[model samples]
Target: MTAENNGTGTPPPEGDDDPFAYLYRQEGGAGGSAQQPGVPRRSYAQVRAVGERQYGAQAGPSPQAAPGQQPGSGPGLPPHQPNAHYAAPETMPGGRAAARRQAAAAGGGPGGPRKNRNGLLIGAIAVVAAVIVGIGAAIVFNDDSGKQSQGQSDNNDVPGQDEDKNPKNPKDGDKKPAKDKPKPTGLPSRTDAADATLAGGATKQTEVAKAQSAGGAYVGGMDKPGASVTWTLKDIPESGKYTVFVRYGVPGKDADSTLSVNGKQSDRPLNMSNFAGAKKGDWEAGWAETYSWIDLKEGTNRVQVACGDSNTCDFVLDQFWLKRGWVK
Candidate 1:
């Protein structure tokens, strides 16, 4: 009813120029929305059809160059070395040709040769890729290890943790009570005080036999001039240096004091071993550093505590301190 004249009518023929020509000439990427004039508007079916034609053409043999010209002389191919051993097949076969076909069928000609070449190329490529991956993995692992070490260090430095594991940590806890330092043999913890009192008010003070006082108290000398006292020293546990604490008291005039162990002047400054500079005195504090690897004799040893004037530092002869080992 809509087309009253349609029953016997025919449509006009389409134009002759290639309607698909626009599909082949574009240079842009495949997925963008930007439009270009002159480019064919493509439906999915049209695009797929054009693509098949192009792919088939490329996959087939390319056009040959002019007769007598080399394969790579045109823009179509890169420069190449002619394969001297490869020759085009002839239409007519000679005895050599027959033999080559037979060899190929037997796995010694075209098939075997091509197969070997492909396998070698693949193996070489795989080895190179494996080496590259190994190097990359090693570098990554080393970086991760370094990060782990840094993390451990950060953990150790976290607040509220025991710094005993820290290299810069300080000493802590109750120090093991000092061991008795070596003292001059044949003397009690107290031996002098000739009218002076003992340090710390501990009544364990007493005089030694005058005979023991000036005796040959050494495998060396007068273990030093003094009333021998119970000398406590740190245990020589390991190799290192330690500090020894001592206290002394006595009376004298304008007298400075000196402390020594076993005939030798102790190797530490003692400018404050006494405050006797003002007269009638009480105990004064002192300290010393003893090197390890030194054997401390048990029991009493003469620790000459002398109190003297500028002309002499006197020996209070009756004071000693508890000792302990501190390592550095």
Candidate 2:
């Protein structure tokens, strides 16, 4: 009965209203009907065995059941017809086989090959480390090369380091001769005043103490006019200015005398001041020195200490000395 008949015991037209007509249509068989209008069809046996196909095996030909016999049933059982409404769970959408295929694609099922995640991770890390090491080595090599170049440049720029490049000459190594130093002037010449020629009642005496002359004698009695002591010095080294240092003792008062060099009177008188700071009339403690600059000849030069008309002569002469230069 067709769907439109609604169990009225009337069959619909051969192919127009039969819902299961595609299941019964046959090709290249005896008593086969015309082609159906809907999808092309397979036999009932083929449709029933589709769910039974193995996952990896190819489908062979299905065995046709004998008439009035059940598929896979022994002879004691009754014959069973194919149910057109029957559907296998594996053949439906979202079935177990499709779920298993999804599981395998997601790498969770037993059929899927697992990948070594740790090995991939470790290999990536090793490649990155190798790259970093190569970069570091290049940097080190460049730094060392730069330092060596700088060191070489510094060595080349320095002077007096490469002996082979700039050899030393013997004349350049020899030192210059030192200039000759002038000979030192002769030492001072000391003459005792007592040994000098005395005139005009200027006599030599040993009465005063602390006289630096020989035998502690000194020239005395030079207080009057025309009294004088003359010294004739000889063997002067050069014709230059000389210092005439006179050692004299006073009665603790300042006195001075006229000085003449080589028979020419000096412009200024010899100063015989009482530098000792002694009490008046203390001749022993009044011993002091005086000097005068005079121009003399290289040979013998006569020096005179006289009591002139304008002189205040109250000093006793002890010693007269000649220094090469004018000094106090």
- Per-prediction count of colliding residue pairs? 24, 0
Per-candidate TM equals 0.21, 0.43
**Span of ten consecutive residues with least summed lDDT in model 1:** 214-223
TM-score of predicted structure 1 = 0.21
Q: What is the lDDT of candidate 2?
A: 0.76
| Candidate 1 lDDT, 1-328, residue by residue in tens | 1211111122213442344433433323434333243443343232232112321233443334444554345556445423333333442256678768878988889868789999999999999999999999999999999999988887766576655664443476546578986644332332222322323322332332221222312111111333233343433333323333333333333323345555566544344333434344322322121222122345333344443222243333432333334533
User: What is candidate 2's lDDT per residue for 262-288, written digit by digit as tens?
Assistant: 889999999999999989999999999
TM-score of candidate 2 against the unseen true structure: 0.43
Candidate 2 ranges with C-alpha deviation above 4 Å: 1-188
Assess the local accuracy of residue 132 in candidate 2 as a C-alpha lDDT between 0 and 100.
100
List clashing residue pairs in candidate 2.
none
Q: Which stretches of candidate 1 lie over 4 Å from their true place?
A: 1-235, 252-254, 267-269, 272-319, 322-328
